[model samples]
Target: MNDVPVAVAAMPSAEGTAVARAAAVVGGPPAVRCTGLARRFGRRWAFSRVDLEVAAGARLLIMGANGSGKTTLLKVISTLIPPSLGAVQIFGHDAGADPAAARARLHLLSHSAGLYEDLSGADNLLVLSRLLGRPLVDPVALLARVGLAPRPEPVRTYSAGMRKRLQLAALLLKDPPLTLLDEPFAALDPAGCGAVEALISGLSGTVIVASHQVGRAARLCDHALLMHEGAARWQGPAARAVEAYTALHGIDNADGGG
Candidate 1:
């Protein structure tokens, strides 16, 4: 066997160092970070003091009943609404100071379909993709992926579930690194629900899902944050977090009964 040259072996390769640095950045930084996050509408606080950190590729489920601030929190994280207090960092970009950069890395799907009612499903997605500077794609393919047939009629004529699927297809076309989904399973038939779940399971980026379907959402998520009355009750592994939320909800009901 030939002996390797000592000079060559001793030198540190620039490419190796660069790769290591990239890995360090990806592994070290949390994909989403919130500190002392609070949002209010008039005198009512939607959520308060919500400190959270989620790494890249994490599936985080926000569990709560109605009026629990799940939608509000997701809106704040997505930079759709400014926080009343504290800070949010998405992929290390400050949402308050650098909303454009943060938004570039995030996609939000609210309860509303957020589509142009007058436009056809394909047209709506095409318009958004162009506006967002995403690659122009065949809307029919995307619609098919979401289990919606290509139709010429306006989205105004679509059923609730069809509209929801159309919106999902549009966002999937954007394919941002961070996704915020508010009640993804709502307004879906059994087949539509299965399609959404499958899509979520296939995603490799970070996801924050706000849903009242605790059991189903918990199954899809690795981590969970349970909220009640605009406050987080527990944040941890999904199963335990669900248990904590159930126990806390029960306690609140018992107190009310008394």
Candidate 2:
């Protein structure tokens, strides 16, 4: 197959370190940048007046209600959907101007399992590996890493947890610079959640996980961004972010399912 020259994000200097943009005034490394981000379905503004910056290798968690623009904000950042009224910059490159370069390092795992039920777990992973333009890793090892050890069965026969884990294995491929996990913990067993948390604990790179699971996010992330009606209300440390959310919403059930 012809390796079409897919432009990679201009490699950042200083050994994988991104430009740190703590303040909007001075420029620095940015994994994600949003200015005046707004989305409108019709007359209603989903969100507006949102500006945010995140440095390299920071794991970000988005906290909000089901319809409060958490997913919308993620979509815009991942370049899946365009913001109607805002400009987004990812990895120091303009999202609208050079999305391809940004997307090379971007991986978005949607709410649904983007796996083929008809194909076996190995086949699904191999297909993704080819698209990533990299050699596929050991399927059995990948499956075992995610606790799906007994392999070589049709994916359609697998349980929802198994499928989700398989999708996660594929997501780990390409070593994407930015990873977006939407409700990543949905439909996992207690053991699986703990395993995933352990796996994500020291994960190196930029990540944005949109979920209402504040407790999990607190343990798993370094930074947290709160979105309400499509705008950023607060952004800071994980613990403080959780505290702010507890004050606004409540501590009850902030962990989400189970």
Candidate 3:
């Protein structure tokens, strides 16, 4: 792990410290910049010609119908997959030219829990800490912070909401400069949703969330982008997200699942 390029050294051991560290870099180049970003799978384009800029410390909400390319856009920004056309810059670092630098400053919490089902929640954090070349500071406290209780049972026994909470705990441990979340509000109870909202509110760095829970997500975000058929249909203040989405589709209820 000593050779790992991830910036785990001197990483914040607590959420408060992480917030403070993120605040120190609040103003600079845009946290994320996409120029003509597009992704294609065989014959169909998942998303195309998507150009956007997210400022540091901004919370952006991405709303669109199912298969409208919200997840694909996030994957490209996270550098998990390359764009068929276009470039992505994370805090001024080109993702294509220098992916490692971009990755070190961001964390992507995708739809999958990305956890080891055979490992306990605490053990999962331990492994991640070692992989990032950091010491396991306090998994118990971290789990609690995400509204998860310490358990001896492996992650395979955890519920969907519990798994989401654990994934959030892992994100806090990294405390990257940019955070990308895909359907973060899915599979959570009211309490779990509240916990997620609180955590997002506390983050001082850039945050991008792709979710179908338009009403709730819009409130937490400062900026909004609506995608339709592989293109950006609208981009503006979060307050008008529902209106923009409604006007495009003529659907009064944008709260439906994606």
Candidate 4:
């Protein structure tokens, strides 16, 4: 049997060094920029007065409790939902002004699997690849790369963890400059979790992840942004950011799972 790829290894120790190396290798403009970014639903705001910048090849983690706008912020950045106020730019393209171009540079993996229940995993990827006007990739091969054995069953028959792997395989079809992940580790099994950590560590571009798993995030990311009540409570290096988040939540650093 072939060995698992380094990108899919689930070891806790695999986080910092690999991600830091990727961050150090690249420079120049920020891959993602949000200025005074805010989002609202009717009379309520999802997130407001948010300013964020992620340098090329950097790994950034977004930490917050439920309803703290982690998901909302990611949606705005991915152009999936429009910001109620302020501006967003991806690779210098104004998200509001040229959403099409901006979106092309980003791949968002949100809570929803975004797959067809009745379709086989490979078929789902094929449809998306066609929609993007990109050449098709062998979905089975891609699934194997993510630590999943390729199967012919419909996506609806797969467990939550399996679905996540299918979604990730779809992502590997494109080489987007920025990847936005919301709660990537949720519902994953031990192996599944490791696969995600390894993939993030191996990515060559910028990444922004919103996860409540502070310890895992801190390990996988070099920078961190903490949000509370729809506002940025803290932002900076992962160590200090982890400290700030722990201080607010009154939790010990070790309790933030890896």
Question: TM per model?
Answer: 0.85, 0.84, 0.88, 0.88
Model 3, runs deviating above 4 Å:
1-27, 256-258
lDDT of 4: 0.78
lDDT of 3 at 54: 76
Model 1 per-residue lDDT at 212: 80
In Å, residue 14's CA in model 3 sits off its true spot by: 30
Candidate 3 residues 92-172, lDDT tens each? 999999999999999999889988999999999999999877787789999989988899999999999999999999899
2 versus 3: better TM-score goes to: 3
Question: How many angstroms is residue 144 displaced in model 1 relative to the true structure, after the best TM-score fit?
Answer: 0.7
The lDDT for every candidate, in the order shown, is 0.76, 0.71, 0.82, 0.78
**Which portions of model 2 miss their true places by more than 4 Å?**
1-28
Candidate 2 per-residue lDDT, tens place, 98-216, comes to 98988887888777778788888988888888877888758778767777775677798988778777877887766677788887787888877776666555355777788888777
Cα RMSD for predicted model 4: 8.1
lDDT of 4 by residue, 95-179 (tens): 9999999999999998999889998888888889898888785777877887777678888899999888887877777768888
Write down the lDDT that model 3 would get: 0.82
Residues 145-174 of candidate 1: C-alpha lDDT, one tens digit per residue: 888999999999999889888878877888
